[model samples]
Target: MPGLSLWLSPPPESSLYRALQDLITDLAGSVPAKDAPVFYPHITITSNIPIECDADEVVAFAASHWAADALATVTIMDFGPAFFKKLFLRIRKTPALTQLARECREKYVYGLATAEEGDPADQAAVWAQDEFDPHLSLLYTNSWPFSDEQKAEFGAKVQTVLETHSTEWTGGLLTLVPTYRSVDEWKPLASQLVGSE
Candidate 1:
């Protein structure tokens, strides 16, 4: 029942990506296994791909439809408290990225369906809840959801590490990842160059 999702990952060759990856690994190491999990640094485009859909078809759809000369420059804006976004860096949005997200949603989520058909009304309602708010999660933790003190402490640690690295993520891979039952189980299914012709 695991669904598919799309993410924009910084080029592995980029220094920024290496720094962020190390930060995530280090932070993930500090938290207990049940509290937080380690994940790659990525700006999620959409995480609503239905489990019923074909992965290869989705990958091909994205490959043919989406093309970007360069991904938006990601800036570490602020911190958040959501479980998936626990101690995360909010990224600045760009027109190209926004458009790309919308197109992906139209295909995978909306399923090219009208308001009255394809998906049931209730199902449609559920899919509509996801909005394209781009962010690069530094930690995925559930322990400090309501603890401001803990969140601030972690945020300070994140800020300290970020200050020593470049925050700009310009371009990378457009990847299709499976959203499994656990973060550790998730992995990329397909990927294409963002700026390739």
Candidate 2:
């Protein structure tokens, strides 16, 4: 059965959120639909929570553990060309961010097993398989091996937009979303604001 996942993202009201949306709009216009698809900015905390995991349980877990503090600041390091990671901002993983991800996986993915905390080897694993390298993706490509020219074009476009802003952003809304379908089909089941009452 398909499952749910946790996503940490900038709330719509934030300037960083608006800037990312604008960048998505600009980039989406140029790429052919078959090449890539636009998506909201997010750093996935955990993917493929068992469908049996109650949505409310997950939301409450996140809220209780993380609501008192804002999410860790994320810095855009560079760009990459992998399919899901196509034209993405590589994020600098901070200790707080790593801890957040580990907690999520412990409760949801590994069923609270200390021995099962996520492994770095899993970083190359597919989406359903777990890892904790955090990044805010800008584009999702349908095809593999995007030509160098195309990748370079996308990189230039990304740099042109992001160069004007600091690479770091902090705080976000945490959401539980069903991950059983296409990107466009996925929607949030519940959400909580970090560091907000």
Candidate 3:
């Protein structure tokens, strides 16, 4: 089964992009140079188990949700230690984002569910369910449980990096990607600019 996900891709000129590059560069110094995952900065709106839906339908839903705004603004408010097993930049949840997530889940996810569908229960949980603490991951890996001293040192480094950068970004692209295994395998099925025709 293909793993589908919705993502907000930050524009290249945004300060958030530059900050993410800097963070990746700094983090790369901590591990073997080849071990760092290829960086593609984005805030995942939701992830779903391979639902049979038209790609155009998914793109249309995203475009319609943000119809009035030419760009969706995201704020990177703070640096967090870990989420979903990776260090990340915590995003301040805004109503626009929250609503967008809700619509994606309702229209694409839960709306596709059926009683006879063999255990749709195992699909990834919907976003914006209880709390919408959106975040942009800075690192992606399975390694875990660093030594206390190492964690402290790395935490300080991440803090220092955050202090030097701006927090906000205007993302113009919404994409539907299908992944086979790792994030590196994600292939864009369709894309739409936030508000353009």
Candidate 4:
């Protein structure tokens, strides 16, 4: 079972990527010395559940719905701790960003129902339509579990690093990835440039 997902990645040379690298380094250093997995800076558009579907068809559906004018001027607004002891840099969600995500879900992940199928309501309800909380993850604490006191102290340190290097980046690309169990196992299936109308 392959888990597919759509994501927006910043160019490696971009300031956003640099900031993310710095934050990750800072977080990694604060944690107990242990192996930490590194991942690209991205904002997830949709996380596909394991289902029987053609990968090419999925790519085509995403390509058709890709909005060239939906390039979002993303801002690193703040920092926060998430579930699973992960720290992330919160992004200011814009209308373009939300609409882009919704469009991807509606067109590709959740399609219109047929009369014979009676709306496929169960599947249609999988993805969220509420407010989008976009962020770039800095690191996960699985390797170095933290106590409540440690979490508070580490969270404050993360916040300090984020505040010191607030960043802005324009997102113009959407990528389809076949995700496996680990971050290192994710492989790109397709990518489409989305910008400039």
Most lDDT-accurate candidate: 1
The residue-by-residue lDDT of candidate 2 on 109-159, one tens digit each, is 766334545553343233233456788878776555657787778778777
Q: Pairs clashing in candidate 4? A: none
Residue-level lDDT of model 3, residues 13-126, one tens digit each, is 666566677776676567543455655667777777354667778977877887354334435433333424366666766767777777776667765778564333333233
How do the candidates rank by lDDT, highest first?
Answer: 1, 2, 3, 4
**lDDT (Cα, tens digit) per residue for candidate 1, span 18-53:** 878888887787675456777888888877687677
Better of 2 and 4 by lDDT: 2
* 2 against 3, candidate with superior TM-score: 2
Give, for candidate 2, the lowest lDDT window spanning 10 residues: 120-129
Q: Where in model 1 is the C-alpha error above 4 Å?
A: 32-34, 67-69, 112-130, 145-153
Candidate 3 lowest-lDDT run of ten: 118-127
List TM-score per model, in order: 0.78, 0.79, 0.72, 0.67
- The TM-score obtained by model 3 is 0.72
lDDT of 4 by residue, 163-196 (tens): 6653555534567777645666667767765442
Full-model lDDT for every candidate:
0.70, 0.69, 0.63, 0.59
| Candidate 2 steric clashes | 0
Clashing residue pairs, backbone N/CA/C < 3 A, model 2:
none
